[model samples]
Target: MSASLREEMELIEKHEEILGERAELLEQMESRREQLKLQRKQQVKEGEAARRRNATLLQDLQKIEDCLRGRQLPPPTILALETKYWASVEESIPAWEHFLQGKGPHPTDGPGQPSRRAKQQLKTHKETTKKTTNDQGLPPRPKPRTAR
Candidate 1:
């Protein structure tokens, strides 16, 4: 072949090599893109599973809260119990004070324990309360509790 013809052929061969390299690069890029797409799909699936798990946990928590609420006492019931406890403390105070004194319940009464002496005082107080109420022609007071 002539010199010019040889140079032209060499140039064409080089061009074809570059085009093949470019095609290979494009194929590699397409493969990588498919792999990335698969990774993204997996991630999306995992996210959906997590979301479902969270929803289930939230439902369980809500059920637990509902059960706790059901078990809780109403405000009125709590208040009533507190009132009764304090009332018993108030009722026992006078007997406690009398016992603390050296004189005890009275000169005639023995040095009785605070509880027994308090019961005696309460009986007298109740009878006197009934007599006064009857004398005044009013309804009697509510019966008081002596103990907790």
Candidate 2:
């Protein structure tokens, strides 16, 4: 064979080897791309599942709040408990007043400061008492005894 022909044949063989290496590299790249695509799809699925779980938790929280409100009673029960509490408080008032010598709520206020409704009732009672006394041939009430 001539040297020129042999050089040409060697170049052809080198080109073929480069083409084979390129094919292998391309196959590796394609496999890596497929793996990456599958990993991204799994990540997206996990994210969607987390979002659904959060939504379920939010719904459960709302249900719990609703149940709590449903179980709550009105102010009347609280008021009744308060009244009992105040009666207990009232029991302590006299002893406290004795200890404090009629100072503060035990002595001065003494639960005597009436609520608006109670004061209105008292005013009506006083007016009725005055009217009945006037109708009778009786003097007006002697200085009314201060309620204890």
Candidate 3:
């Protein structure tokens, strides 16, 4: 073959290789664009769901506030229960105060403060201790002075 013709064939081959590489790179760019589009759609869906949940929560809170505003006082049943609960608590205060002041027998099982079971045990112990002292002919212990 002639020298110029050989040089033209080599140039044509180089051009074909460059076109192939360009096509491959364009394909990769198109794929990446599609992936980003899907990600954006997913994010939009999640944001809409979050907004819907927030609106629902706000509506529930508003309903609760409206209900509270409609009633100045609780029902009679609730009031009675609350009164009874407070009376019971008031009745127990003297014993709790004595226990807290270290004048009564301490609970044996727990640390720092007493649990409900420990308080019950303490009450039982106080009763038994009183009975035993009296039965043994020991003089009754002096009562601890109270602020009340």
Q: Which candidate is the best by lDDT?
A: 3
Could you arrange the candidates by TM-score from highest to lowest? 1, 3, 2
lDDT of 1 by residue, 1-148 (tens): 6999999999999999999999999999999999999999999999999999999999999999999988967699888999999999998777767767854554334554455667788999999998887779766688988996
TM-score of 1: 0.46
Sequence-dependent TM-score of model 3: 0.44
**Residues 84-142, model 3: lDDT tens digits:** 99999998788778878977744333466776667888999999999987779767689
Ranking of candidates on lDDT, top first: 3, 1, 2
User: Over 4 Å off in model 3, which ranges?
Assistant: 1-7, 73-148
Residue pair clashes in candidate 3: none
Q: Which stretches of candidate 2 lie over 4 Å from their true place?
A: 69-148
On residues 60-103, what C-alpha lDDT tens digit does candidate 2 reach at each position? 99999999988957689888998899999988877676747733
Output the better candidate (1/2) by lDDT: 1
Query: Which candidate's TM-score is highest?
Result: 1
Question: What's the alpha carbon RMSD for model 1?
Answer: 23.0
Give candidates' CA RMSD values in order.
23.0, 22.9, 15.5
